[model samples]
Target: MKATQKGRSPRGILAFVVAMLLLSGSLRLGSIGIAVASSTTDVDPKLGNVEAVSECVTDAETHELMELLKARSEQISALEAEQEKRQIELANAEATILENLSRVEEAETRLSQTIQRVDGASSKDVNKLTSVYESMKPKDAALLFEQMSPDFAAGFLAQMSPSAAAGILSGLTSEKAYTVSVVLAGRNANAPKQ
Candidate 1:
């Protein structure tokens, strides 16, 4: 009976250790289940709140970008309007310049016509005076020529016929005729040959 009692005592101690290990394992599993349940309940709302916050940030950024685009668009429109106004001013300035040029051209044309009429009348008067001098007697013409400058007398003689000019030259005093002859000879000395 003592030998059997010793054998049962060892088996009882082994059974006590196995029961404590099973109880500790079950407690750990129960604690792990409670942690998983609590984490799921807390994390779901946190994830939803994070999504909402992300959406709000995206909306703010979009609104800011829209405002920036609107400001830039208005600035561009102002620049375009200023450019158009400058173009209109330039066009007006161009029109004014062209009108002034046209007026200048008209004035120049009128001045030219007036000069032509004056020149024509002067030419006719000179021609009539030359004819009167030619019709006069050589003695009378020479008397008038003696009182004139050498150059002035030479100009009249040059416009007459050769016979009429010779008659007047023959009637002049030798000294006066020589001076007038010198003036007529040299009158065209500076003329261009071409």
Candidate 2:
């Protein structure tokens, strides 16, 4: 009997573990009580009661609910912040796009005006010079030939009548006409041909 007691000394620890597992499993308190009463009459004073179990379950559930609510609140706040940032970025991008489009429109208008001004001035200058060349006699025209390019004379001469050209040609000295011819050969007589 003494050897049996010494060898089986760990029986108390096994019983404690088995009791805990039984309580935590499908075994009800009534079954545990019956089993314990039949096995050992000595009841442990440290064992918790039914009220403690109810309170523990309630507290654990309450803590879990609080944690869930806290996580939800934090998630909502983060989402709201992200949404606000995106909205601001969208507004800024839209404003920048509108501003760039406005600038492009303004630049286009200015470029169009500049082109019109250049074309108008060019047309006016061509008309004015042609009129001046036609009004002067050939001899007087020859005198001004040095003032303008020979190509200008040749183009103007081509547009005038043969009789009128002869008068102008007769009045001009041969040396001047020869110089004009040489200058005309080197340049396009119909420059700005358009």
Candidate 3:
């Protein structure tokens, strides 16, 4: 009876080992490897016991679990790096949009100033410009004239005292005058007489 009782402890140990295996079924990593290795390995029959086999199997599982966790950590790090790269690219695109907006605003300001200049000039103002042109050096007059609408300059010239107009006309090279004449004849042909 005592001998039967001692043999029964091995059965209890087997039950405990099976219980651990069931509980650890959901645990991650080399579960297949340990089950296969333990089944195939020959036990030193003298040391063979369910407790020892369970402990050895559990140790193998722990190492495999650590390796699995390390792999997952590395994958997570790579994903995080990719996310950061995309965020930086998005920020750079936003900065480029802001820079473009600033440039557009500056261009709009310059256009508004040019509109104001055209709006403020008058027929009298136009006539004064011709006198100013006749008094200046030819190169200075030409440069200033080039900046004005050719039609505006033409009418101003027509209103000037003939002598003053003649002086300025003589100052211009024919080629420069021809270009101004072409401009005045084209899109600005019907431009205000003023």
Candidate achieving higher lDDT, 1 or 3: 1
Identify the superior model by TM-score, candidate 2 or candidate 3.
Answer: 2
Each model's lDDT comes to 0.88, 0.72, 0.72
Per-residue CA lDDT of model 2 for 1-194, tens digit only, reads: 56457775567768878989987775677788888555544444677432222222357788999889999999999999999999999999999999999999999999999999999998687767757766877678666664655667666665666665556656666876776667646566567867
- Model 3 weakest lDDT span, ten residues long: 49-58
Instruction: Using TM-score, rank the candidates from best to worst.
Output: 1, 2, 3
Candidate with maximal TM-score: 1
Overall local distance difference test of candidate 2: 0.72
Candidate 1 — which residues are off by over 4 angstroms? 1-79, 173-176
- Please report, as a residue range, the 10-residue window in candidate 2 with the lowest summed lDDT: 48-57
Question: Which structure among the candidates has the greatest lDDT?
Answer: 1
lDDT of 3 at 63: 88
Clashes of 1: 0
